[model samples]
Structures are given as C-alpha cells and as structure tokens.
Target: MTLLPVDEALERILDGVKALPGEMVPIEEADGRVLAAPLSAMRTQPPFDASAMDGYAVRAADVETPRAVRLRVIGESAAGNRFHGAVGASEAVRIFTGAPVPEGADTILIQENADLLDDGSIEATSTVASGRHIRRAGLDFVEGDVVLEQGRRLGPAGVGLAAAAGHAMLSVTERPLVAIIATGDELVRPGEACGPDQIVASNGFAIGALAKSEGAQILDLGIVGDDSAEITAAVQRAAAAGAHVLVTLGGASVGARDLVRQALLDAGMSLDFWKIAMRPGKPLMFGRLEHRNSRNPDSTSRPDTTGTMRVLGLPGNPVSSLVCAHLFLRPLVARLGQRSHTPDLRAAVLASALRENDDRRDYIRASVASGPEGLIATPFSLQDSSMLTTLAAANALIVREPGAPAAEPGSRCRVLMLA
Candidate 1:
C-alpha cells in the first residue's frame, strides 16, 4: 500500500469529528474546560452608581469654587450599605470605596483633599468635577450581555469573568475518555525484572499522560502479550468501558508477532489508513470499531451511548509513539473537548546548516532558543527513534517538507513548540 501523506492522513483521521455533549459544572470546577455555549451576564455589575474611592460625597457645584467650601457631614456609606437621604446644599456624606453614591451627590471629594473640622464638617481644599471617582451602574457589564463565547477554554480569568457575570455554574464539554493498551511479550511494567530480550513498558504511561494533558480521561489496560486472542479481548474491554478513543502501543507493524491489526480486523474495525509518509512514525494505523452493546462498565452512571469508537495503533518505538501522539492524538483530544485543533507553528531561523530531505516529511527534534534575529532552532545530531533522552531534551520540532532541498545556516524554517 502507498504511504499516505502526513496532511492527508491527519485529515482522514479527523474526518466527521465533532465535540462531545456538554454537562453543567460549578464555576469552581469549570477551569480548564471548554465552554459549550455562550455565557451571558445575569445581573448588571455595580447594580447602582457606586463610589470608586474612600472620600466624601457632595454635589460638584458645592466644591467647585476656588475658595474652600465647607459642608456638614450628615451620614456615612460603606460597601453593601447606602445612605437613603439626599445631600442638601452645604451637606456631604462620608463614603468608602464600593459604597453606593447617595442621592443628590454628583461627585466625590477624596478624603485627602478634604479637611475635617471639630464641628463634624469638612472643608474641600480642591475643585472637584462631576462624576469623578464614581463607578456608573453597569460599568463593567450589563445584564444579558455575552461575556464568554462558545468553544472558549475557561482559564483563571475566564472563570472569574463568569463568576462576575453571576454564573454559579457553566456548561462545558465532556472530557474525552481514552483507553490505552500495550502489546509485546518482551515488555514488562516499570520496576519489574527483565531478561536480556525484555524491556520495560513506558509507552502506555507516556501516551496516557499526553492524553490527560489534553483534558482526556485515561484508562490504561496494561500490557497484553503478542497474541491475537489477548489483543482481541483487550479491544473488547476498551469497547465495553465506553472509551471514545483506543490507543494501542506496539504490534502495529507487519512483523510476525504483530497481531494488533489482524485482531482489530477480526473484532470488526473499519480500517481508515495504515501508514504515513513521515519520519519517526511511519507505521501509524487509524480505524473505527462499532460496539454492539453501548454500555460503560467503568462507571455506574451511563453516558450517551456511542456507536463507533476511534482506534489509533502506534509503533512500539518510544519516541515514535510520543511524536505521533503530539502530532495526531493531541489534536483529536482537543477536538473532542470542543477546543481548537489547529497546530501552532512558529517561524524561526535554523541555527545550523541541514542536509537535503527524502520523500518523507521530517519532524526533527531540536533545541529552540531566542536569538537576536528571533528564535533559532538547532536539530540534534542523532535522531534515532529509540532514543528517549533526545526527545526529553527537545523543546521544539523542526518541520521539513518532503523532498526539500538542503539549506544553509540561518535559513527560515517552521517549528512546533512543545509545552
């Protein structure tokens, strides 16, 4: 089969994808969740004209003359408390920040600009203008005004805005549940003893973390030996658990022990694509499976019954699996969470000269640094798929188009920054 282009493969994988259903959650729990609908203000901010500073409230005309004006202090107003009586001529009311502006008062004379007398009166020392140091009603937001739009991720500021808008609860998209299965007879869990041919299983942990960072719930099925029956059972368990996306690590290539593909086919998976024309992750596979019984075994509370479960079969190589997750799985999770799915690519100058590329697209792990000319991306000398140290040290991925020509130092290039 011809290897699909990276762009085309991603397009196929994300076809017909839409955000999941939304659920109502308290504003405190809405942080980091995507808004499913527009959030409107329930009550006007400042409901009434209020004071913006600790001062005395008086008519502007009463304190406008060049000469100092004296006024009797009749009452006091503080936040959540208001003076009901109007301020008559030559009269003032002491007011604190956030206090409602009393009736007949048009300006605030800051306490520093006023001198208090022994007879319970204040002499204005400076000319004051009308409406100064007063927050008008609905100054921040009016009732029914849309404060947050649909599909926006709720950060700290967003949550605060919603709270200010009188929203105790917000509607947010449901978190995507991702099930992971690791396959390989030569694999064992971390901290376990291994033989000469055996290695510790790390892909499931890394992949689960990657999915979780994207706001997806993870269901790790642990390691399954390279057997068709065992692989089939794991796939069934994923379906039974109501996983939206199932990610399989290893056993995807066409090796003798590679039974993931055949097992998925036997378990009624519709293959979308098998391989892609990309470095580090060439044997990636995507498919969909229909679950006969749409019930969730993990939770007593039932979610919406979903007919099809998306499946991603990744290579056994550690770096390859992580790179593929960054390029593909993260976007899928974002889409399910109702967030934007576009890759964030930034332009940078190559720190060193690079060789010409082959037909496959390259995602070279590199160290990106800010330079006088902007960002400078320098690729590591060694890019072996099995090297985890290089992947760990990389802060960005330098993107090179297929069959591109060689470039000299300081050449312009595009990079995907890793968070």
Candidate 2:
C-alpha cells in the first residue's frame, strides 16, 4: 500500500550506492570500461608543427601571382623528415602530409593548385594564405593536460581519443562481481518439461545477460525454491564469495511463502524502502547487508568494506523483474562500474489518444517509428505484466503519470526508450 514516485526513488537509490573500486586495465581490453581516474597526456599531440598537405611549403608572399612566378624547390621533405634548411624569399620546400614544416615557411600551396615547372622548380598558380594547412605543435593537446576524465565509458571514439593523447593503458573502475539468484518452487529450467504451475525461471538468465552487457562480471547462481533455509544459505554463501552486489528474484512482497525478506534480514540488511508507484514492478526492495563475519566497534570506527554488501530483491514476475532491474539494478551496476554516462534517455509524445491514466505511474510497452515530425511512439494493444512477448516487441515506454488527465493524440508525454 506504499509507493514512491519514479525520479525520487532513483535519486535515493543513487545517493546510497557507492562506486566500485578501480583497477588497472590494458588499453587493448579497455573498450566499454568506465574510467576510474582522470588520464593526463604523456606527450603532446602532433609533437611538432607538421605540414597538413601534399604541396610546397613556402612563405605566403612567394605565391602571390598564380601564373608566371617561378620558385626554386630547395629541398624535399616528407613525413618524419624535417627540412633543415630554411626557405629563401623565392624558394619553397617540397613537403608531404604530416611532414614537419620547414623553417621560415608559413603556408602550404596545395600541389593540385600549383604546376611543377620544368627544372624541378614550382610555379605558383594561386594565391596562398598564411598559416593555412599547418598542424602546430601540441595543436590537439599539450602534455599533462587532463585528456580523459573519470567515470567516462570508453567507446570507440573515446578509445581513439585516449590513444591520440598518448595513453596505452587506462585505470578504470573494476568490474563489480555480481551474483544473480532466482528462487521459485514452481520454476523449472528452460529446455525442461513443465508441470501445471511451472515457469522456466528465464528472467534470471535474461538479467544476467543484461548485466554482462553492461560490463559487469556476473555469477549466475541458478534457482532456489520456496524454502527459507535454502534461500538464506545461498545468500550467505554468495556474500562469503566476495560478491559486491547480490540480486535475487521473488519473495519480496508480503506473500505467506515469501522468504526473501526474512533471508535478507537474517543476512543483516537494514531494509530501506520497498514498493514503488509504478506498474509491473511495485514489489521492489533496496538495502545494504552488514558483513556476517565482521566484528562491531561500538557504532564507531567502521571499516569501509563491512556492512557494504548491496542487495536488490526483485519481484517474481518476469516482466516486473526486468522492469525493476532497469529502474534499480542497472543503475546500481552502473554506479559500481563508475560509469557516469547514463544513456541519454529522451522523451517523446504518444501519437494516439490515451483514454485511461491509472492511479499509478505506468510504463506502457510501445514501439517507436520515425515520423515526418521525429519519432512517433505507438503503444502496443496488449500490455500484461506477465507477457514477456509484448515486452520483447516493445522498444519504449509511454511514461504516464499517476492520475493523469485523458491524453489527446498530440499531447506532450514522456517516453522512456527501451531499445
């Protein structure tokens, strides 16, 4: 009978979570890892002022006339080769791209825009602007500048930037070792036969896969039943194995056979708040567990690691569990990974009229397609909390607020993208 709004719950959960520890990882294996520490440039980019074109490096004044001016080609310069001699007033250096610009040469006349005269000299055919086509020393970045900040996810562009700034290894947040456990007596593994009330316990597998996608190390603990002792034993064993976070499915609500709440209490977790004002995921629990093997110090001088185990007790319904994971568990993992880049979730309006806005906030399954006016989100006709097929087909959520007015076709509505 208690429910908190979406944004408030997210903020509270984020405030309580701690970032994962940092570790040194090789650059070759660094894509998608969150940077734990800011990286400084080891050496400046472009190290020296280099030519930016395959042309003649000359003083701007020498190329003033396009047709009749004859300039002697003093020496040849290519990439990695520097012209030691300076260009005279009417002389130019043959330079290729990435070659160091010769002394006293302030411009590059592109070869396409100039004709090579008969005696290994060059004839200027266009007026050249000074300082054109030149990559100055440290043009991109200077040494010791902070190139990559902490909490950045290293994608391809980020990786390329890091490499350009002279980093071969990066210090990134250590991937938190998380253990996922699903519990239900009526649950059977996929590829197995099902009795009257048996489900495949497929949500756990899906969640584990999603966690792995976020670069978290997942330990799939398989399934446990409705037995309290078995569940409690599994919880303790997972904690003992140094798991930073333990996510469990089922037994979160006030059900009679529900054992997750009791098991979490036995493991010394101070339950925060449970349940939220959202459909398909109302029975969610967030809390921290005190170490089962730590000694108390009279409420003072506590160690950093003790009482720091994080746990999320999710609902048993597959759709609800996955939705709750998206709301709570994914952010928890991202925080631990020190990933500051929360995927940019943009909002869009519902394309059609919506009749009912229930008393609770709704994340309706929807598909989005491009319209002449941007993305148009269309809600799926069938939305059941137990229907995973509908969830699979959906790529977004029409975020309907509690007690919202009946919406018209072109109203400004918030949509949470899922794709």
Candidate 3:
C-alpha cells in the first residue's frame, strides 16, 4: 500500500475541527486563556479630569507668564477625596497623583516648577499651560469600548487591562481534554522494576506535556500491555471520559503484535489514514470515534458515550513519538483550544554536505548556531529514531524535500526550530 503524504494527512486530521465551547472564568484565572467574546469597558476611565502628578491645580490663565506668580492654597485634593469647590482666580488647590482636578482648574503646576511660601501660597516658577499634567476623562478607555477582541489570548497585559475595564470575570474557550495511552508489553512505568526485555514508558509524559503547552487537559491511561482486551478497555475509558483527542503510543505498525489499529476499529473507530510518508515516524494512524447514544446502550456491544474523539496512534520509538507530536498533535490541540498554531520554521545555511533523500520527506535533527552570515545548521552524523539523547541535543530539524539531489555545504535550507 502507498504511504500517505504528511501534508495530506495533517489536512485530513484538521479538516472539520472546530474550537470547543466557551466557559466563564474569573479574571484572576484567565491568564493564557483565549477570549470567547469581545470584552468592553464597563465604565469610562478617569470619570473626571484628574491630576497626573503631585502638584497644585490652578487656572492656566493665572500663571500664563513664566515670571513668579503667587496663588493662595485653597483646599487639598487627594485620590478618592476630591475638592468639590472650584478654583477661583489667584487660587490653587493642593493635589496628588490620580486626584480629581478642582472644577475650575485647567492645568497643574508641578511641585518642582513651583515653590511653597510661608504665607500659605505657592509661587509658580514656570508657566503652566492649559491641560498640563491633567488626565482627561476617558483618556485610557471609554465605556462600551472593546478592550479585548474575541479569540484573543489573554496574557499578563491583557489580564490587567480586563481588570481595569471593570471585568471581574471573562468568557474564555474551554480547554480540550486529551486522553493518552501507552501500549506494548516491553514497557514499564518509571521507578518500577523492569524485566530484562522491558524499558520504562515515557511517550505518555512527553505527549501529555506537549498537549498541555497547547492548552489541553490530560488524562493519562498509563501503560497497557500487548493485550487486545486491555487496549480495547483503555479506548473505552477514553471515550467515557469525553476526551477530545486520544493519543496512543506504540502498536501502530504492521508487526505481529501491532494490535492497536484493529482494537480501535473493533471499538467503532473509522480509520482516516494508517501510514505517513515521513522519516522517523511512518506508522502513524488517525481515526475518529463517534459517540453512541446512552439510551441505546444495548444497541451495540460498545460502552455508552458522548461527543466524538479524534484518535492518533504514534510509533513507540521515543524520538519518532516526539517528532510526530510536534508535527501533528500540537496543531490538533491548538485548534481545539481556539489558539492559532504555526510551526516555527526558519531559513538557515547548511554547515556541511548531505546525501540525497528518498520519496519520504526527511526531518534531520540538527544543531543550530548563529554565524557571521546568518543561522548555520549542522545535521548530526547519527540519525537513529530511538535515540532520545540525540533528539534532546538537537535544537532544530533541517527539512529536506523528497527526492532532492545531494547538496554541498553552504546550501540554503528551511528548518523547524525546536528551541
């Protein structure tokens, strides 16, 4: 059978996916969340003309000239305590930052530009222009103005802006829940005694973390050995938990023990594709499981369920699993969580010569560094799919198109940044 191209496989995975529904969350808990609705200001900022500095509020006409001018200090105006009286001619009001400017004041004389006299008056050392050091009403934002647009990710500044806009709670997209299952008999959980043929399971943790970084909640099903019944049981649990996406590690290839694909089919999943034409990870699988109605629990032998779940089966090789996650799983989670996703691809110069590629598009792990000209990428000599250390040492992947001719050093290439 012919292998599916990587681009086509990804397009199929995201063909009709839509963001999950929205939920109401407190503003304090809204950081890093996507806004579901446009957030408008509840009230105008600086409801009244306010002082922008700790100084004296006076009439601009009273001190228009730069020469010394004396004005009697009438009353004090501090934040939250406004001097309701107006500033008459030759009169000034002591004011602090954020204090409401007196009704008749048109400017502020900064303390540094003024001197306090023993006769309860202030001498203006500099000319006070109209509107100087005064914050007009609605300067920051007006009531009914949208402070944050829909589908915007709330960061530190966004959260603070929402609070200043008088929003105690905000509407944000719900986080997608992903269920992860690690399969294979030669795998054991970390910290446990491993048999001679068994290695510690790790894909679940890495995949789970990757999904989380894209805003998906995780449900780890732990390690399921090479039993068809156990694999089917784990699939049922994921459906029961209403996982938006179910990621399974191992048992995707056509080996004798590759039972994951068949087990999922038995559990009512419609296969989308089986294999991908990509190096390191080729036995990738994708499918969708429709939820069966609970009312007709006995209509089929499967467990009752609600909502559809996208299933992705990855190869067991550590490096393959991680690479495929960056290529596929990251976007799927971002799509569900209402966040924009784009690969961090960059252009770089090859530091050494490389051989020609085959039909499968290759993602060569490489170390990237800044050069005198630009970024220089050097592919590692060893490209084993199971070596996690090599993958860890790599900061980028040199992307080589299929069937490309051998290239010499200094060739321009595209790279996907991992750092």
Which candidate number has the best TM-score? 1
> On residues 1-419, what C-alpha lDDT tens digit does candidate 1 reach at each position?
67899999888888888899898888989988889999999999989999999999999999987336679999999998899899989999999999999999999999999988989899898989999999999999999999899999889999999999999989999888899999999999999999999999999999999998888889889999989999999999898878889999999998899999999999999999998999989999999998744555545567557567899999999999999999999999999888876777999999898899998899999999999979999999999999999999999999999998998998999998986
Which is better, 1 or 2, measured by lDDT?
Answer: 1
Extract clashing residue pairs from model 1. none
TM-score for all models, in order of appearance:
0.94, 0.86, 0.93
lDDT of each: 0.92, 0.82, 0.90
C-alpha RMSD of each candidate structure in angstroms: 1.9, 4.7, 3.8
Off by over 4 Å in 1: 193-196, 292-299
Which model scores highest in lDDT? 1
Evaluate residue 137 in candidate 3 and report its C-alpha lDDT on the 0 to 100 scale: 98
* Tens digits of lDDT, candidate 2, 68-109: 578899898898778888988889899999999998999999
Per-model clash counts, in order, read: 0, 0, 0
Q: Which clashing pairs does model 3 show?
A: none
lDDT of 3 at 334: 93
- Candidate numbers sorted by lDDT from highest down: 1, 3, 2
Q: Which stretches of model 2 miss by more than 4 angstroms?
A: 4-8, 188-198, 212-215, 254-257, 292-307, 340-358, 370-376, 405-412
Candidate 3: residue 39 Cα off by (Å): 1.5
